[model samples]
Target: MNRKVTIIASNGNLFDAYKVFNIAAAAGASDDEVAIFFTFDGLNLIHKDLHQHLPVPAGKKHDLERFKKANVPSIPEMLQMIQEMNVKLIACQMSMNVMNVKKEDLVDGVDVGGAATFLDFAENADVSLTF
Candidate 1:
């Protein structure tokens, strides 16, 4: 039987974003049903303009080169891959209001909703994670 995976993405840093996307992608590729809830600064991951330009954590600018050398996929590329793999991306409604982000600010195929929406998907999740 396929497992249900739910993820909460609450960090805005590039490193965290990379980890979340990578894990989500892997789970989806394994035929698990995956859902990512973007809250607080995590909403940046689904934003069209911001997702590609996320910053490394403070004083970690040097890691950019390391990521490149490791052949890490770009944020946009991962987003595309996850979408193609049928991963569900949800943006927090309250976070969007606080950040002044509109539905149009997100990439295509992202669902915009509140905590209840995510909880509905997460309630019976076989695996739950936070980033």
Candidate 2:
């Protein structure tokens, strides 16, 4: 019963976060326990206010507009899916402090802790990835 732990380290785009969530769900379905740790800019991924603020890919004519029209999953929706699948979402305590984020403002069911907590989970994970 090896586990998979993934830490989202970047806040590039919504698509990236979506991809990570999809991967985690697939792994969990296969019986590998999944955990997702949000750190650095990645912290925005779990914030209700900032989740939808990610850029929608620029240039390439109408790409951003078309993508928006396709009804992409909102960050909150993705987070809900992650929760429903029993994925562990951890908020980096250091990042939260630096960003002045209050625990009360975080998405529901998120566990708050520092790097050590994430490291402990990673150590036990049979597969670990930093995104």
Candidate 3:
């Protein structure tokens, strides 16, 4: 059966971005309704420029190389894949205001909204995760 999956991403690191995308992609591929709520640092994952060059946390440089060598999809590639799968990508409006992020700075097709919006989507989620 199809399920509802909600993910909360509040981290800025590459690892967290990978985790969030991996989970969302998996759920979406399984025909789940996936929504990712990006708040705080997590918003970096959806930032058009930042997402293309997400920073690897110190000491994890080797892991990044490994992922690349293993042919792990790039952040932009994963975003495209998920978008094609129709996953919901929401950028937290409050976080944007506090962080000085503008809608134009985000990738195309992302919805800009507040907590109530995310909560409303997550309300019936069969799986909810934070990364």
Candidate 4:
């Protein structure tokens, strides 16, 4: 059976990262092969340092207690878990250039490509989604 591929045209939103990685983790845990394609500011999610400690933003009175109570993994933890499960993380080449990100700036093992590379993979995927 063809495995699902989730392609996210991501912007650098901390909350959005949590949501997409949450889905990817659930799918990966289920033995469903998956990929997360990062573009736009989504590149921030793969940065070696930034992704680990994203602030929840201001004036929201964000509930850290709730987050702790729920045991939801942090972004870095989620990324690590998904990678351990063999979920593919692709960083867009163009986006990287636009954002002034060097490949070395990203965490290890992230694949780099344009749409042609990703779309080819998407063609055979059992499912596809974007964030």
Instruction: State in Å the error of residue 71, model 2.
Output: 7.2
Name the 10 consecutive residues with the lowest summed lDDT in model 4: 53-62
Error of 4 at 58 (Å): 4.4
Error of 4 at 127 (Å): 2.2
Candidate 3 yields a Cα-based lDDT of 0.94
Which candidate would rank higher by TM-score, 2 or 4?
A: 4
lDDT of each: 0.94, 0.74, 0.94, 0.83
| Model 3 lDDT per residue over 18-93, tens place | 9999999999899999999999999999998999888899977889779989999998999899999999999999
lDDT of 2 at 123: 80
**Between which residue pairs do clashes occur in model 4?**
none
**Is candidate 1 or 4 superior in lDDT?**
1
In model 2, where is the ten-residue run with the lowest total lDDT? Answer: 55-64
Model 2 vs. true fold: TM: 0.81
lDDT per residue for candidate 1 within 11-118, as digits (tens), equals 987988999999999998899999999999999898899998997888999888998999999999999999999999999999999989999989999998999999
Q: To one decimal, what is the Cα RMSD in angstroms of model 3 from the true structure?
A: 0.8
RMSD (Å) of each candidate, 1 decimal: 0.8, 2.6, 0.8, 1.7
Worst 10 residues of 1 by lDDT: 55-64
- lDDT, model 1, position 48: 91
Where in model 1 is the C-alpha error above 4 Å? none
User: Per-residue lDDT tens digits of candidate 4, residues 20-54?
Assistant: 88888888988887988889878888889888766
Structural similarity to truth (TM-score) of each candidate: 0.97, 0.81, 0.97, 0.90
lDDT of 2 by residue, 1-131 (tens): 64675655556466667667767767767777788888877777777677767655456446556656988666677678778878888898988898898878777888998888878878867777777
